[model samples]
Target: MDFFNFLAFYLYVYKFFLPKIGRVLLFREKRIGISQQGESTLEEEKSQIRHGVETLVTEALHISKGVLGDNLTQTSQWCEKKKEEIQKRNWKAINGSYISSIGERALSGRLAFLPLFPALPPQILWSTVSSKLKTLNNTSS
Candidate 1:
């Protein structure tokens, strides 16, 4: 399979296996008398997911190198560049910009009832919110 397909398959498998891994980790933690709350904290879950992704990427890179030989160098470099790009991303700034835009629209009275009413033409804010709410409802149910 191509790199995108390979990456996606690994992600799918990782997601499939993650719960089993979490169970094993929880079992070990209980045996050691740690994690007395009987649940993994959010940070611990994030750490496990991050580590799992890193491991999958590293394994994929090795397999690609074996299959592609000399051509894999470019792919490895591209992966590293993309990793750097992801690491350099400023999520807070991005969120701030989105919130500021919404605030500006609201203050200008263009989106007076943002949560209840849709914005004027050329903006699909209500549709976005509707879809998001549907997704949340589906997930919760």
Candidate 2:
């Protein structure tokens, strides 16, 4: 698959797996469940998710910049639209993969671009994408 597909797969893995990992790991301990180590592991996983998300965002921004320039058109619209979809749909989805985004900030960040794609459900996905576009606007300003 391409880079965007890679990113989507990466994010999906972390987004779905991290929390489940944390739950299982933490609960595997004592009757009370969740040792200090388990908690720390969860935190570490969260940190990794955050880092991965940042990397994903960086790569996407780089791609958009390369393809869309400072201006957007139909030719380059998919990148920005995809960005919005990611941000909007999975602001919450990213929460579990060892890290998370506050939904409002993420949504605001992604919505910075216009002529965004129209899609169904999966709010966090859309939010992610919209946030990416927003952040790029912030950087340019």
lDDT on C-alpha atoms for all candidate structures: 0.70, 0.69
Candidate 2, 27-117: lDDT as tens digits:
7765345567678889999999999999999999999897776465764687888888887677634543323334446556555543364
After best superposition, candidate 1 residue 38: deviation in angstroms?
9.9
Residue range 10-75, candidate 1, lDDT tens digits: 898799888889899999978766554435665688899999999999999999878897667878
True lDDT of residue 72, candidate 1:
78
lDDT score of residue 71 within candidate 1: 67
Error of 1 at 124 (Å): 99
lDDT for position 92 in model 2:
36
Best by TM-score: 2
Query: What does candidate 1 score on TM?
Result: 0.22
Whole-structure CA lDDT of model 1 = 0.70
Candidate 2 TM-score versus the reference: 0.27
